[model samples]
Target: MIIILLILSVIIGVFLGKYFGKSQSFAKNLLILSAGFLITVCVSEVFPEVYEAEDHNIGIWIIGGVLLQMILESLTKGFEHGHFHHHHEEKNILPIALMAGMFVHAFLEGIPLANITDVTSPYLLGIVFHNLPISFILGTFLLREKNNIFSWFIITLFALASPLGMVFGDYFNPEWQPYFLALVGGIFLHISSVIIFESNKNHKMDWQKLFLVIAGVGLALVNHLFHAHH
Candidate 1:
């Protein structure tokens, strides 16, 4: 079931990428929605469980994951945004490196999803939903750069990274699960915060975008309520 969910997520990501690659506004809105949903998942769901587990030592893992992501992002110089227009010759090395970093993050996230006993459904749903927008944004960048084959390949690979993590998590003992969740939660928190901060309009406030964010949170809240009722 988990594997099937992951596969469905990848397919949905591909379809969303292909569909939204044309509209910058739609893409931006999708990203905002994804950011809100991800934040809710991390804060309302994942963090609570980690805290309940009483693993203060996991803070080290979270900090390490955040620092690792910072270093990786520094190497890419924000290429994940796909706005680079340098006349200097483009090399595939940096892009490949960025993908590797993302893959590591995604793979780690999958571990917790696989090990989840109580929160499995919502966690998996959040992951699948959140990944779709990321895939779309990355796809948009690739399309703009005119790298069709590489774009598809990277998107597909990103989709698979989580499931691979699940496989690892399934094989591993339960004792290490808290550390894994903390690490991935930290990474997700970092990524979602960056997206929200970057998406802020510097010159003026965008009410529509704000509303979209609220809508995203509302959706998650509603889902949470439904799950609770069930």
Candidate 2:
């Protein structure tokens, strides 16, 4: 289901970008909210689970993941935080470096899902939903750069990255799940924090964006509660 949803998200994103022109404002708000959702899931679910191991001191690994994302952003140029710098009039060549960074992040995020107790889980939902806005971002970027077979090829590769990570992770040892979860938690922490903080210029807060962020956090909380009861 998770893999299916991820692929569907890519298709939906392509449709959206095709019918509608570039949606910068909508994409920005979506990015903000997506960041909020990710942070909430990391705090409310992932952190607690990874910290459960008695012998596992995952602090270093978490920090390492954070640093890794920082380096990735250097290559992606903050696309993970919805900072799409390219305009429609830019060159028609693909941004291989940026996509490479995003693929790495998406792939790593799927690792823990393969070993999760609840196959249908909030973490899975968080990742799927989080990818929603990202898919839009990718669609816009790719279509603008190369609206051809090459662009679809890149998009297909992006869609497959997480599912491929799940396949790899399923064969990985179960004992390592906690450490990988912590690493992913740290990666989420970094991405979400960047989206929230670096979004508005001059630190000016828009009330609508603020409300969206709040709504994102609220939705995650409700999802967590609902899952806990079930």
Candidate 3:
């Protein structure tokens, strides 16, 4: 059921982009909102749980995840965020590196899901939220490229990557889940921080972006408080 939701989230995003991909600002706003929710979850939930569970140096894995994401971003060219479009316009060739990076990133995110207790897990919600804008942009990219065979193939793999990771995690050693969570937490941190702090063209802070970010954080906290008591 969770696996299906993950795939459906991507599918929904892709269709949304297909029909309404004109507004770059709106997409960025969504990204900001998602980032705010994501980082709050990480700081408020994931990091604390991992640290509480283990006394050893999980920071190593967290730092490793951050570096891994950096490498992946080099390949993805920031498509995981809002830096989409025109990347392949001139070449019109397949972006194998981008796909590879995206696939691995999504897959890693799902691996930790195998250990999560329920659908309400913040990690689960965070991925579902983050993947929407990503796949939406991918849909827009496909439209720009005329929606060829490669586009379908790309979409399929991207959609399946996280679910497959969850399956893989089901077989993975249970004890190691914390370390992997730490790793993913780091990846989330980097992605969200970059989105929130990366300035606009004039290098000035946009008040609207700031407000949406605050709203995202507030929503996450409210949800957290609600779940804590209920």
Per-model TM-score versus the true fold: 0.83, 0.91, 0.94
C-alpha lDDT of candidate 3 relative to the true structure: 0.86
Model 3 RMSD, rounded to 1 decimal:
1.6
Please list all clashing residue pairs in model 2, or write none if there are none. none
Flag the better candidate by lDDT, 2 or 3.
3
lDDT of 2 by residue, 1-230 (tens): 77787678767866665555366888888878888888999999998888887546687888988999998888777767776656335543346876688789889988887886564487887787778777787788777546898678777888888888888999889999989888888998998888776646676877888898898899889889989998
Residue runs of model 2 more than 4 Å from their true location after superposition: 87-94, 117-120
**What's the CA error at residue 72 for candidate 3, in Å?**
0.3
What lDDT does model 2 reach? 0.80
Report the number of the highest-lDDT candidate: 3
Candidate 1 wrong stretches, greater than 4 Å: 75-93, 117-120, 143-151
Arranged by lDDT with the best first, the candidates are 3, 2, 1
Among these predictions, the greatest TM-score belongs to 3
Candidate 3 segments whose C-alpha is farther than 4 A from its true place: 90-94
